[model samples]
Target: VDIEVVQETGSTNADLMSRLPLLQRPVLRVAVHQTAGRGRAGRPWLTVPGGMLTFSLAWHLPQAPQNLLGLPLAIGVALAECLNTLNQNVQLKWPNDILRDGKKLAGILLESAAASEGGTWIVAGIGLNLQVSDELEAQVGRALADAPWLAQMDRNLLLAQLLNALASALQQFAGHGFSAFLPRWNALHAYANQSVHILDHGQILHAGIALGVDLLGCLVLQTEQGQVNVLAGDVSLRPA
Candidate 1:
């Protein structure tokens, strides 16, 4: 893994994609500051200078397993483990959101290519608010809140820990797929025992939450009626 710490870049993921085609060799690029970052649903991620950890990791998984449907959930577990070393109580929200104290502390975005030949190259991007100011907070709106625990923390050290954890998760996922990591994913899940509303395809699935992710990393919802397995989508917490 090669890290390229730049002052600023227009969407680290975009930058890597642009250069990947021209490079003779395969490599990973990590942009410390992504000026135009983004998230799921093509929403812009506010990446202002100071106190925010933003980076994109590009890797070519040659022998990637086809059943890596729970890769994102596994990444959440890795992030929780990394943050635990910093003494933070972190939990994973479905689809790839990192929560601390019921607020978003970090997020992971994974994008995969069909592979021009055969193998798949994935770009796993991560963003975190280490110490956002009030001015920036106002710009962020209700999407996120200030994380005080991030204050006075070492960004480099945190990044290193998170990368290491993610690397470990990727290795395990590539080898044993979802089955090897589902238990850890369930343990770090924030809404495992709570009621949640699943929003997908203009339909809402209201059900009681069961522990652990299905093969596709979906939230296993055990409603009053029966057990229903939900695949990836947006979910809102309903009062239990």
Candidate 2:
């Protein structure tokens, strides 16, 4: 894997995606200051220099996965596992949100493109709030969460651990799909077996009990209607 750090960028994901055709092996790009980061649904992602960790990993796959939907969830599991080793109880929200004590500590965004020679190229972008500041909170318009132990840890060391975990997880996923990670992911699921709301486009789609994820990594919600397999949507364990 190759790693590069930049003082600032518009978006690490965009930077790597533009170079996908030239990349042969896995590469990691870290941005100390991301000026135009984005989240799910085109929501703006604000980061404070030196207070957040923002990076993107570009990996080439031999072929597209049978299902691409689970990739983000697998990445979330990898991140949660890496953070948990730091003595922090990190949990995963469906799709790719990382939470600690029910507050979002991090988020993930994935983009892919077809390789010119063959197969698919993937870019996984991650943003983690290491030490939230008043400025960040004000910019985000809410109270944000951070890893308390980051104050005592070196950023480079932590980044290395996360990259290692991600590499291992990606290898496993390539071989066995999300089935290999379903058990571990469920164990860390923040709302397992809890009543939750499934929303799409700001409309309530289902109100049901969270049944955890399936082998394909879809959220299985047991609603009064039936067991609904949600491939992608917004889920809230609490009433919205």
By lDDT, who's the top model here? 2
Task: Give TM-scores for every candidate, taking all chains together and pairing residue i with residue i.
Answer: 0.87, 0.93
lDDT of 2 by residue, 43-161 (tens): 78887777778999999898888988888989999989999988677998887889898778999999899999889999999999888888888988877887768646887998889
List model 1 lDDT by residue over 16-48, tens digit each: 766654444445556667778887766778855
Candidate 2: Cα lDDT at 10: 90
Question: Candidate 1: where is the Cα deviation over 4 Å?
Answer: 23-26, 134-138, 143-151, 201-207, 233-240
- TM-score, prediction 2: 0.93
Backbone clash numbers for all candidates listed: 0, 0
| Runs of candidate 2 exceeding 4 Å displacement | 233-240
